[model samples]
Target chain A: MSPPESAPSIQDKLILLVEDNPDDETLTLRALSKNGIRHRIEVVRDGVEALDFLFARGAHATRVGWGMPTVTLLDLKLPRVNGLEVLRQIRADARTRNLPVVVLTSSREDEDLIQSYGLGANSYIRKPVDFVQFMDAVRQVGNYWLILNEEPPGHVP
Target chain B: MSASLIVPLALSASLVVAGLSWWNVVLHRRLRAGRDREEARCSAGPSPEEEQWRRAALEAAGQADQLRLQLRETQRELASLSYSISHDMRAPLRGIDGFSQALAEDYGDCLDATAHDYLRRVRAGATQLNLLIEDLLSLSRIVRAPYRPEEVDLSALVAAAAGELSAAEPMRQLHWDVQSGVAALGDRALLDVALRHLLVNAWKFTAGRIAARISFRVLETPGPEWPPGVPVYEVRDNGVGFDMQYAGKLFGAFQKMHVPEDFPGGRGIGLATVQRIVARHGGSVRADATPQEGAAFTFSLTSAPAGGEPPGAEVALPAGRMPVPGPGMTVPRHPTNAR
Candidate 1:
């Protein structure tokens, strides 16, 4: 049988990208761009900024018309606030509890994975070192979360 | 005429003395011949069967010596391999941890959240890898450390170990029952390591319990006793006991009775370390438990010689008048109670 038709690409979905590194951010965006994923992307430098963007706190407080992103890509290590704590807060809050939070890190440690899962991370992914591999990971994650999966309506809070 | 008769009598007496001396010589010669004959009978040439048996014994002894030499060589190789793994494996793990940390520090603003998450995981994985390497190294060191046996006040060590465990998690309610004057002859440091591992196991196992009870005591073996030697020190706990079937494998490295999710935090190296330390001291450790009941770890160590004397002495009473039996000191009335 012919390969199943690709589901209608949900290219308009928004993705909240939480990263602290410039090179990684650029690399990720380039990978997504090359994959022809036409989605609105929001970049936050650290866990604190990501929390603010999601909760409309601090700098995002004035952005009154903002909506929740379709998915959040979380890093375990970040300045001022860490990824595990952010995931904990997200899961603890009823408004964001169901929001898909993917833990993407370079850590291959079992403890991190266990802790991340314990804290209710939706998915866990390890960042590859090779440039081509990294790009492939980005594309697959983008395609899966942005196009294939369905998310709830954006929350007010 | 009378003088000439007296001279002839003296000559006859001299001839009698000479004859007695010749008889004594002949008797000595006969006794010598009899002794030689007996010796010859005893040392007669071995039978063919006996000769074959002697040759076989010699061959077996030679084979045994060769096997022993091979065993020694194998042990040496094992030690060397452990050393190399402990030392060589750490450098790469350090690089992973260090570089991950550097990456997070040097580039903080350009990446999106997803990339940052991935980097953080890398760092955590590296740190965890490093910890495992360190634990394995410590285990190897335990195996290699020279075992110097001496009198060790196990009771005091138990108390001290409990105190340290309590300090680690002050909020937990832990009850300790350690008998005083319980001593054993062992490498004090190694024994301490074993006790600490057992105590830590108790602490971790009882994390969810409302009230945790831990005990350390010395039990007297009742039977026809062997040569006076090392005494046994026991550490028991009323915690999340494991199934009895897996008790035999408890001391193996990386042998975990519970899942990581259930226990949350442990590398499962503690009991393995205890086993290594005990074995180095020429002791053996055993575990008995029922699921959800509790676990008791019993180990026998050569009791440190008393009075600074050598081992192999008869047991003696404590110097002071013996006090009435208290809780753990008394022999249990029932067989179940003994456990």
Candidate 2:
């Protein structure tokens, strides 16, 4: 049997990044770093990998200890499983039900925004095309979710 | 033998001459017949049946060509727009702006103020282009989005829009005179969008008024252009209005009547979008305004009569102050209101 879960510390705060485009991934990394966040960011290239990393299944099963990241930066357009489906699964499971998933996408469609909120995303941010605005947005998201906001209680199996 | 040959030759010559004369007569008869037919055609013009057939064929062909051209153009436009949205034309711009920022941040010590200023300009240009792209996307979406039609309470929509705008600027002394029970059969979401644009436009233009008065009510008499029994809804505001000379340009995309200094933050897309949505609903929209008095817009929605007096029963106000058709706001008198 696995050991009991414990409260995560600020120093050990991890960020799960679900992004497909290499350019966006790089920009996001730069933006986060600009916010003075030195936390480890686990980058998954697609939705399938995102789920695998979060559930500790497939390639991520043998990692040292399985714990939810402080927040998940999820991109809506992904390979295999889409962002909305990933969000649905996250909310479906008891273990990750309350995990803070922030939808980061380039879509400004009303339908996409409505669906993202409807599916229980903590926040939906449309990535600004301008770098300065993009940086500011990412900085705010990082500061708010990582430093300011309180995390929900962890699920104990 | 000589006598016999001469007699036969003479007989053959006579026979040949007779045959030639008969052929000439036949040719003359055919030419006369042709001339008569030509003259008859000239005198009578074309037969009605033949003329109709020819006209129908030409018209159908012309229409088909026009439709084909239009279809091709629409397809090309929709394809390019979808590609732009899905592949994201903004990505390249982001790359430019992001890398520029990166350069400035990483190498600030090496660059002069002039160089830094150049970077700022580049970022600003990229940001402006981003806004234009967003506006273009919205315009395209309005055209390409799937339409859903439903019964909409327009009075409620206007009241809600006004409430939101008033809440945004609670300090502004605004008076709203919105008539109740204005219902229409149309797409609720799209109609709501139109109402927002119209009301926001009114709210924006009315910024200078000490006690701004805006009204939403039915025009008692619609012009002859409108079909009978169709209710013409009017949204009027007592604010700075445009000259009637430029009224023709109001609904054009990116067309602005006012200078940026007087009124800013308008991309000039709101009215164009309103026009497109109303046109899509099979309706017509028109506007009239004086330079300083105010602007009034009257429009009719397609399909079914909307916004006449409520059939029976005093209709309850939809969670807002009842629209009093107050006389304080004197909109320019229209020609049709002579009665």
Candidate 3:
């Protein structure tokens, strides 16, 4: 008896992956490629870059009016700002309040899970070490969030 | 005239004595009332026998405090060791698994049949090592981490695990029945792991069977599986059962029973983790099975905290970490060949 979800209006498929570890970054890229996600995948090494990219500040101020990525895969442990703080900043901002943030990390601690969901994360995905399973997880993420899930409001101009 | 003077003096003396005695009575009554009020405010006035027990309890408590400190130190050490193993060992495994796959993909035609088989085996070994490291870390973590006690919907947890098992292998014809409203007071995340392990074991042992009937039912009646009035849970499966004589070895670390040859993908640490979780809750689990007649695991949750206190209306209380054999455990050099 509920209303149907709003369909996505943006044609560009941009995925912003915030990860610091080089090995994991490589593995994630491989998994994303294996899943055939040929979207404009922009990888940021730490939380600082992630915030800058999202908010159009610091180094990324050149693209001030650019639209936000469809899905932001946020990693918890980063060099400068860390993932939880980035998530808090994202939730605090009015422009990116409804942005779909999926926490992708290796930590299975209950503390991290509670904190991620507490910060209004849309989903939390624990990265499995096995290559095959990791690939499958990436595929599911792409299929659901990128392909099926509705975009947040205030995107179309 | 001298007699009259003596009489007045005697009356004065009597008056003085009477006033002093009256004040003494009032003071005595006040003292008795104060003592009685203090007694009423306390939980209970210990009897002579209870007082003696309290002295002995104090001595025992002093000894227990020392043991608790020792246990905490050991837990800290295990946490560090687990970190080293996870970071130090797993990094190489990723390299091996990743590069080998790249090798196989990039240059498959240049390699001979033997070379191809050798690379395949290398990748498989690295994958197996990854699984083993994962199992070791989980085992260490279950013991090292603090407990969280709360009301857990056990039936729903088992159903979820069953759904995952079936989803993992969508082709299998698996029938799992979980009784409704089966609940317990314990850590939710921990109890889920224990339940998942039991279910996974049943699912794994029954791999080749055409008909796999797994049931998770609670014993409503007061039976011997639990105390006179307590209920216990039973996980029954018509899977490949082992001899009862080997049951003693089932809950050991890196157990040789579940080699890659006999079973496809198991490190034999799942049951051990279940045992650790049960022990943390001050509960006990037992297994019985006949070869090919099926196996059943029955567990009763006493759910005592690390302090061994009876569970009251406590919610999500973090228990002190109890020490278990961690870095001291010996993992086989080649787990697949160890069996």
Maximum-DockQ candidate:
2
Better of 2 and 3 by DockQ: 2
TM-score of each: 0.47, 0.61, 0.58
Residue-level error in angstroms, candidate 2, position B117: 3.5
Q: What's the TM for model 1?
A: 0.47
In the order shown, the chain A TM-scores of the predictions are: 0.89, 0.90, 0.90
Tens digits of lDDT, candidate 2, B213-288: 9999877888786767777889999999889998998987678999888898887878877876675454668998
Candidates 1 and 2: which is better by lDDT? 2
Which pairs clash in the backbone of model 3? none
Q: Candidate 3 residues B1-339, lDDT tens each? A: 112332233223222222222222232233334334434544576556444544443443343344344445555555665655654565456667776776777798898889989988998898777777777667766765556677899999999899888999999998888898998877788899999999999998888888888999987673554655445788999998888888998876666454578886677878877777765554668888998878999876663222333222222212222111123322111100111
Which segments of model 1 are wrong by more than 4 Å? Answer: A1-157, B1-75, B108-110, B221-231, B302-339
- When candidate 2 is compared with the true two-chain complex, its DockQ is 0.31
Q: Which residue ranges in model 3 land beyond 4 Å of their true spot?
A: A1-12, A153-157, B1-54, B65-95, B144-250, B281-339
For model 1, residues B85-153, the per-residue Cα lDDT tens digits are 443344344445545555665686777889889987887786666556556656655654555667788
lDDT of 3 at A26: 83
Stretches off by above 4 angstroms in model 2 are A1-13, A44-71, A78-101, A110-124, A130-133, A136-157, B1-87, B109-113, B139-153, B163-167, B170-177, B209-213, B303-339
